[model samples]
Target: MQFRPTLWPTLITIPALVVLVMFGWWQVQRLQWKTELIQELEIRGAGPAIPLLVDARISAEDLMFRRVTVTGHYMHEAEMHLLNRVRDGIPGINVFTPLVRANGGGALLVNRGWVPIDWPGTSIEDHDVEPVIVEVTGVVRIPDPPGWLTPGNEPEKNAWYFIDLAGMSAAAGVLPFTDYYVFATGEKNLAGEPVPWLAPDPNEWRVDLPNNHLTYAITWFSLAGVLFIIYVIYHTRRRGPDDG
Candidate 1:
């Protein structure tokens, strides 16, 4: 009777091979997702802006991120500055004010634009610039999720940057607003103080799929091949002497 210990190299190699295959598969899946997302954004960007609320009717209201146009009166009373935004390398504030539809019915919060950080507790003087009815065109986008580090809309304390649509509506004594608001793109009213009309830059959104999976797959398969070759050589050389 004879007993022999299993070769530790082959035993460890099996698990390493399995892990490499799984990692490669995961990266392939990620590449596919990125490709699909880029295609969708391109398609959406090509369409014409929806002009009226009725024209863009649909389920689930946060149409933020979609290009849209609306005319309304700027509700100066409900205006608040979203804190801690940066512009040109300086700490700044984002101005957000409610826009009451000119024809009446509902109000939408407009993210006017960013302003350089001012005194810690001072509000931007609205009267310094008179209110004027204006037309705004821009893409709709949902507010950043709570706890995303953007200043939350706080009317009572007069501090805010992120436009929490639902919260803004509640604070304005208007229940329920569109789940999203327009990022004003052109023809902003009352310019200078509160610069509006900013389109989101998409450089960061481009898909950059990596080809490392093939490299990894090759590495694993190569190692497996080397192991098999060594095993054969070792057994063949040893058995040659045994055969004699």
Candidate 2:
């Protein structure tokens, strides 16, 4: 007929406290990261495209949709057709080619853009445009494999889209290229492939991490209040009338 504070509350309350604290901490970290990203974008978003090999390094995580300049040759044999890609609302393959940099010691994988899947079951002939080096300007982007979910990159099947930089480098025999790739920004190359490079427009960037821990904290504190009220009412009702 009476409620007691015992091991059950300890077990449940302790774990809940731990989880609430950890969740709040994680949200704080996310809020901080989002703030820093916004500030950085404000300062650097207006700059011209950066060279892939520039002294100022940019990580793929941060550079997606950012404009960048790169120079390299198309490794046509290594062109991979990423399944289920689309352009202008048509299903297609996303073509990825290795760019042997003009700087002469490294290569960078470049996304040539999407092409219709009408060429299904047929391998497109490889063509060399120019042995001479040329520059490409485009936005930096993360790999978007064709499927909403893709199996792993299969070099043997020649299927790919998600840029697993390490895996791609190894499979393409690029033995030591940088760990990221760029989307070529322009008309198709001389080989008649489409080259669509997008810039980091404001409409393209999204920053949507909110801190609701304060609200959550209030909810939790309210629970604590309800528990206290229930405890007080139960003891008052159970106490003998004359007991002091």
Candidate 3:
């Protein structure tokens, strides 16, 4: 048998194989990175809630997914409503209120959790309670920048599609707000009205990071292998009596 691949097929196959293998390798790298990130988050999230200080020197990466406590009063008048949240098949919105910290710890945004979109009353006055100092415990979250598909926030209307820390702070007139926000854990009422606050388990991290990179890597590698096999079969030929 003689193995003589056509020039054009060889040229095309080599480059295609290289590209597929590179893609596979890239996905493998991503898989490792994502695994490490998930592990780190789980470790940090499992620890007891730490007291969050206004002047704490903790890096943003260190604070992510970690539970923390803060003493403050909710500035309900400046509440920002995150649109398009759903709970139990009911379309709703997540209410994010600025918490003015006690003893001058600066303000922190707290996601107070969801309320139905058609919940009666529109004004903040309808939801706010009498100003009272309180302590809030929840997980720290660093909001990602709004993607191209995200709708622009309407500060004038107090409607938000995504968390915009600086923009929300400025609009609410809360100076020097914390860069990260807390997803308040536990159910609570809005001035005697029912609101289903998210109560995530304090002992375990809710891992939502998708990890399909390994699957993707395997797919790419398999495709590369199939292509190589096909190329080989195409080029190989049985020798005949006329052959020298």
Candidate 4:
């Protein structure tokens, strides 16, 4: 008496398995696209900074990744450190300071840059630079709400996981500002090359994070394989001599 393979379970699952495989392949394609885009932006987008004048024509925060300059006073008294941010694999916090426009229209949140973890300064009063009218060139970046898996921001403790524009504006008490932030450029690595610093790169296929579509594709395909194996083994055992 022996058991054998049947068609019923395969019939039920083949369609589903095919769909999963297709999804996995789609993710792989997306990985290639994302890799190319990230490289392109980092290469071609790197350029000299644009100095934004007091009467500069702003897009009400519509622009992104475009290099621009904002010359103003650093309101260090209202600054806040973006908690748990990192740079070039170094543990540090992003310095968020409100750059009050010299012409007096309003202010914009400026990510001054990252300082070493050992650098002193936990409060807004611990400014590394003197308060003076200055010009800064940076890339425009839009604020994003914290991801679902990300922990919520703690405004009371002055710890932030993401840039909540409204919350920052209210907390800092500077207003009429645009709904965008600027990440100052001219930050060089030890090799003396410009780094994007805090650019809004959506789909970087980082090896450490590994959230690319290829990884997703592999997962779905692997699941399909497991499902097929299970269906075969279970149906084989279910078939008896009489059924055969």
Best by lDDT, which number? Answer: 3
Model 3, span 100-167: residue lDDT tens: 88768778888876677887543477755666666777888888778899899898988899998999
TM-score of model 4 vs. true structure:
0.66
TM-score of each: 0.61, 0.62, 0.82, 0.66
Residue 161, candidate 2: C-alpha displacement in angstroms: 5.1
Model 2 lDDT tens row, 1-244: 3445566655666666666566656666665776777666544444688766643355666676567777656676666666766656877776777778766747787766666677542253535333434577766655544457666667788877566777777888877556556766542244454432211111222333344555655665566556556544644445466645
User: Per-residue alpha-carbon lDDT of model 4 for 1-244, expressed as tens digits?
Assistant: 2446578776888898898888878888888887876665454336556665445576634355667767666677777778776767867777787878766758888877667656655455455455465666777776666788887778788887888888888888867457678777633233333322332321221212234676787898899899888876776654456773
lDDT of 3 at 189: 36
Model 3 earns a TM-score of: 0.82
**lDDT per residue (tens digit) for residues 61-135 in model 1:** 334345677877776666666777776687777667777877664787777666666643225453344556677
**How accurate locally is residue 106 in candidate 3, as Cα lDDT from 0 to 100?**
79
Question: Per-residue lDDT for 153 in model 1?
Answer: 57
Provide the overall lDDT of each model, using Cα atoms, as 2-decimal numbers.
Answer: 0.60, 0.60, 0.79, 0.67
Ranking by lDDT: 3, 4, 2, 1
Error of 2 at 118 (Å): 2.0
Question: What are the RMSDs of all candidates, in order?
Answer: 7.1, 6.2, 4.2, 7.4
Best TM-score goes to which candidate? 3
Off by over 4 Å in 3: 6-12, 121-123, 127-129, 187-205
lDDT of 1 at 31: 58
- Candidate 3 residue 190 Cα shift, in angstroms, is 18
